[model samples]
Target chain A: MGNTKKNDRRDFLSKFGTAFIAGAALSPLISNASELLETENNVTEIKNFKGSFEDLLGGDYTNIKLRMQDDVRRALKKPMKDRKWAMAIDLRKCVGCNACTVACIAENALPPGVVYRPVIKEEIGTYPNVSKINLPKPCMQCDEPPCVDVCPVEATWKREDGIVVIDYEACIGCRYCMTACPYEHRMFDFGEKYSDGLPLVANYDKRPSFEYGKEWDREDRHSSPIGNVRKCTFCAHRLDEGLLPQCLTTCIGGANYFGDLNDEDSVIAKLVSRLNVFRLKEEMGTEPNVYYIR
Target chain B: MKKIFYILWGIAFILGCIGVAQRFMYGHELANYGNRVVWGLWVAMYIYFIGLSAGAFLLSSLVYVFKIKMFEKVGKLALITALVTLLCALLSIWFDLGHMWRAYEVITRPNLPHSMMAWMIWLYSAYFLLLVLETLYAFRIESGKYDGDKLKSYQKKLGILATIGIPLAIAFHGGVGALFGVVAANPMWHSALTPIFFLVGAIASGSALFTLIFAFFWDNKKGEYYQNMLKTLAKIVLVAVLFDVLLEWAELSIALWMGSPEHTAGFRAMLFGQYWYVFWIFHLLFGVVIPVWILATKKNGIAIGWASLLVAFTFIGVRLNIVVPGLIGEKIPGEASAYIQPRLTYNYFPSMMEWLVGIFIVAFGIGLFYLGNKYFKLTKENNSVKS
Candidate 1:
């Protein structure tokens, strides 16, 4: 009886998908019409993506951030499980300004020594032959994330949207995950603020930054994140609100790109499609979502 | 002499309390581990103490499982040492965790099977329970209430428990090695031989601990039987020490032969880096060579005790060598120098708070052992040896 019911449900779902796809394919001219129209979210995305002819090209549109914001809006139309968030950084455009680093700290309200994204600037070759190279390192958010595997308490895991998130409440703060991450991406929050060793901490030091769509208040000294392992979530909270990651928008060099890899039209999907783009420690077989066009 | 030891222990206990206080008040801010070298003094100490527990337990198994008559007297004492050292190991690691309060989550919401660390916690919890049960039965058998048949049955029961514990001890301590070994990202620890190396090291250090305690503190050490027992332990320690060194050489040689910098970087840093003395002077000379030479040749009980102490204590240098050097080198090229903050740098040395807390833990363990010995009269053997 159970098998018959399961088979029926599976058959119905497949049949329904087949009919809808077949009907959608018939309208070759209207192919670009919203697959997202099935959900209310997809309808809202069209409004966000479309504008007047001049308005489309205007509004301080210096670079890819504006274009990527539309891609984010489109991706947000789909259910989170269907969306695979990714990032691509063009090394040629990066000037090693450390703007992304500062922006990340400011956005996350990160305490001293807790950094999510650090732009590693290296000057290759001897002094006369020296040339600079910049690499903005974030949590690789690996398909096979070593960090998730080592977490004893099941405190951290990769979400369906390709973001690895930590349940601060559940974390025993062993920092085993920190050791396991090949890229050295995870940071232990020692509960230190910028206002540490001062007479009184400033108000900003106590303010919470929303991560994973939940406010993480550092006001209480012995609370969750204060003594927890923290890492980049690709601005998961901001993604829910159809905004690009803080580092992407604040990037002075316009070197960073963000979008959904699940969608063929998304910016990151197109960027990473190029053969020149590569991932960090590809030999480690982490299958990192973030790629670099070096 | 005892008065001097007590005074120093008292001083260490006081300092330890202060260290615990600072740990609670400041969190990991006072710790020097940072992002690069995530595991530091406490982690090394935890592994060291656990190794001691595993070693002692295995030694006790010789009396119960293998039915060795020579080590029968120290069976209760061995079980007690294993229990106390296990407690110290747990406490050391508990202090290391970010949220010590949430340690229960490891049992409640563990990432089982996949995580070697989770396996370690589960394995040790079983080991801890087994140790407690075996110690209780040893106490029962020691009470001298039962006649020959009942006593034999109890010994049989103990034999079964110790038999069960042999693999449990090996699995957990070997699992600890496998925990580091499984992290393929760190080439230094990612080896098939790591688990075997750990088991051998545990035997070497744990047997040395048993020998040290038996040689110096046992009540009937002046007796010919007691002296013979110490001599046997010296031989066991000699064999174990040699076996452990052989495995170490195999590990080092294979990594060097591989010729990958990622594999060799940790070894290079350990042998020739800033703290070369930790490996060469402390581990090689004091931990291995001096101890090995004395254990092999010395018949004097005092000399054996000193040798055992050197192996047991300087094994921390070995533990430190195992942990810190693996993390000293950068994963990405130019990554260490990429960021300039003190926390971001590759260099690490434990802070004052860390050292104080470490002293406190060892002092605390000694305090417990002292109490346990006094309460249980662990020095008194079940069957008195005729001099």
Candidate 2:
């Protein structure tokens, strides 16, 4: 009975889309009349499937997106104190496409030399026996962030939700945090532009990055962030808006996962409990929220 | 000779003006130091000048705090050198700052105890205040402002100031080293010996510089008193240099002894990689070996002056060696090749603008010294001010 109900809704949505396209064709003013229409029973077949793109491609995924969306909605229902956000990256699945890196840049409007996520490519063994490993690094957002304690002005701190954030206005750009960070995730903005050699600064290059949900313009040299140290905040702004982090959503291999770790049933919680999971620089005792599965 | 010196100073001043203009007009965009190697020539120079100031101030305390009469004549000179170098050191760091104006936040709203740099700034401020008061009392004593009882009281106050300054100078310079040492991420600088190394290096370089000034610029160079002072200062510099060499050897050999890849990579880069000449040619030969040779063999003031000048100038190389090597290696192997950008590379050299700014700082210091000598009566006893 449940399966039939899902199919009915999926079929109804596809029919509605076709009708809308047909209706638009009757009006000469409508543009791209053919491409606007989508015809596929994949939606109908996977109506019960949640969010992962595997659902569209007929893979037997647990519907990670749908489960995560539900998980997000459920977690949001609880007070902020009960939430502990975490990220898990499965190294075996990552192909080093760097799509997540580019998506993060676009989402954050990061300038040149200010990379928040960089995929480290390494090869093990010798000659023909060699195997490639791609590790994507982001700010650890450690429970005891070394970068936080070294800050001379207390400009950066770990949020209650487990994201380490910087107050750009308060940061003095001493680069102490940059040196203290073992992972070297922090970047100092020297007011460089991607639009160098262009006749003018490109409009897109000048667009404000909405980090921490605050619009920051990079037009001026003396602006808060232009001379401040910057790092990843786990896409905190997107998390608050019921969206998974941009990097997780854009990972082509579905290697990355993020959710509230406080929920025992969440994907991240289950992943963290696995023995294969590990963190970078574990001996440093930073207790980072981001974990990797070997 | 004087005219030629003036001309050279003029040329340097104008060139430095261009660099300073570019710095303010464009910001660090012109500097080659990127995110990975975040500091460069200016930072090295800052530490170098601060080392000079601390070393010279500590030497002056021998006259006031310890009452070593053999060092009496150069006490005022050492004080002035400390003050001037402190200014230059502060300026170098200010220019290096990404936000030059926000530096006061370190004082106004410091995150104390947690930040080593905050402690450094506060200690330097206290040291600066003490220095100024100490200089005033020293001048008042020489300016003939009081009778026997009053003069004795002034001397007592100066002694107290110098005694207080001993710890301030040690803390400030040690704090400079601690600033780098506390960075656990960079294995090259993470050591208990770092602060001790910095303190000893400051004494070595600073005393060498003071000895040179006394040898070359003292008015009564032909007198027996002058010759005796020059000999004693040279001996002091020699001892400091020997101590500094011992520390340098300890730092180098310990890192490279076991051939541990992680521990020795930065040292290897300093010794064998590009710009290796900075450590070998500029520092080892010109800074240490030659100065040590001249100070040991020659009793003449002129020879000591020449040798001490070489040590003083080439100490910049020592400063650079300390800073750049620690940042040369990648934290993770192959990390440098992972991302390719001008500002992302493990390799670094100061940009042309960086060199020009450094030249300007040196020229500015020389010009200030010249003015102080001529008008402030820095080299004269009981000379009246023109005003």
Candidate 3:
């Protein structure tokens, strides 16, 4: 009986040892082959390897990715309700310094004869009882986005992130979008350059840590495909880096706030909850991103 | 007589060429189009020409489908004018587009359901095809190439097609008007009646234009049939002008009654401000009242011809008033009023390039018209022989 048990133990030990050795041997070979395949495919395997292993180990990277994907899926699955981003302007806080207008123009690198942001000076009452209100206006970035709706080429679209962006390459310069926009925020890029020294401005370079969104070689202003309608992007390029828009940063009166409305703790969320905010042209059903506070 | 026609066409062609050159070199800066007046004379001209095309084609349909033998001489001429005017309308839009090269993208990447202009593109293309087919059928009949049996059979078939084309023409112009009417942003153009008004105006202006063209042909001794044609056309013009007046009055009255500050201000600009004279004297009196009076009261052929000339002349002004004033209103209160005056300091005129291109297109149209007339025997006798 004792002899039989010893033989059995030896057999078990040998089988276990061989299986371990085979696994160990095959792992490197498989990994190396995959690495070679990755090189051939011009893809870095490290990027793919990250979350898969983390998922197996229940790590935070996997959790975050899953959570983000779920959130996106859920948001998309739901019916479009209050999907439009809106802003309320507090007429009480705005001062007629024109800082926001200037900053927006500088950030957008707007050519001569184009103004992306403009402040309207209004007198509310007669001379004695008159209250001067300086209203700074940007592209309303409407939910319905009349500009996007009317673009014949589907060149302009509302992003999942709540900004309307124009694909310069696809736009046909029909100007139908400009005519459709009630806010009149849309502008035609008429191939005007800054060489005439009308206060030359470069918006992207003005920021300290600007990353190019789309690859465009400098020295070709016309390369952006002129004749397409353009408007304020709410500083989408800046937001990608967790930075505020140039207009929001440079507002002398601190009238503008940029934040995620999804976050309850965000400044915009808090202000919207507390203040009586109103959008321009609510009757039009555009559900604009910009709001005004009384 | 042919030499004079050629001379006049040549002059117009040269002027149009100069306009196109100005546009190409300097951009729309040559035109009196700015932020305030984003649409101006070119857009007005586009609508005017489109109206003329639609009107002339509908008249030709009367001869084709209704078998109006008295109107036979002007039928081919109407078709030619319709085709030519359609070309002019297209040229005006081409000039208006900021990126003319990217025009093909409008078709290749069409945004379905949302774009009114895209719908316009498709509708206009279909209408143009219908016009081409109709023109060919007319040609075949006039040339006597088809025997009586074939001609009768073809006419029977084409008459049905021509009937379908009348409503299509109405829809085409009405759709163009709807393009503006649907833009709720511009209150002046946002009325439900806008499409109806556009259709009515189209018929009125179209009849007026045909009257003028026919009278010119008659005066030049092109044919005696034009005199009888003008007499019939005068009655059509009178009715159209009266309807146009009623619609204009109703549109304004509704705006006034609405009592919206923007609508009121826009109406005031048309009635009393910079556009007041254009609204009152040009569009109202000359376009509607005076032309209607002369057409209705005058019996003399020369007087009727002059009345038609007045109608044609003033319709251009009416189109301008329709397109420009609404765009010129305040986009946002407390901001600068979007109104633009036609002064050199504030606005632009069509530069040489713009003129040249415009001339080229007009010349091209006339040249095509002349070629069409020469190749096809466009006379009553020829048409009768085939039938």
Superposed Cα deviation of residue B300, candidate 3 (Å): 3.5
Candidates sorted on TM-score, descending? 2, 1, 3
Candidate 1 lDDT tens digits, A1-294: 122234553344334334334443443655433332333442233234322212322443323456679889998888889999999997865767788889888888888888999888887888655556889998888999999989898989999898999998898889888878889999988888777778999888998978778889998778878889898999888988999999987665556888999988666777788877999999999999999986
Best by DockQ: 2
lDDT of 2: 0.83
Docking class of 1: medium
Instruction: Give residue B296's lDDT in candidate 1 (0 to 100).
Output: 80
Q: Where does candidate 3 stray beyond 4 Å?
A: A1-88, A194-212, A215-225, B1-9, B218-227, B337-371, B374-386
Instruction: Select the stronger candidate by DockQ from 1 and 2.
Output: 2
Taking the true A–B contacts (Cα pairs closer than 8 Å), what share appears in each candidate? 0.78, 0.65, 0.46
Candidate 1 docks with a DockQ of 0.55
| Per-residue lDDT of model 1, residues B4-25, tens digit only | 9999999999999999999999
- For candidate 2, the clash count comes to 1
Residue B365 local lDDT, model 1: 97
Instruction: Count backbone clashes in candidate 3.
Output: 38
How would you encode candidate 3's per-residue C-alpha lDDT over B121-166 as one tens digit per residue? 7777788988888877876776667877898877776787788888
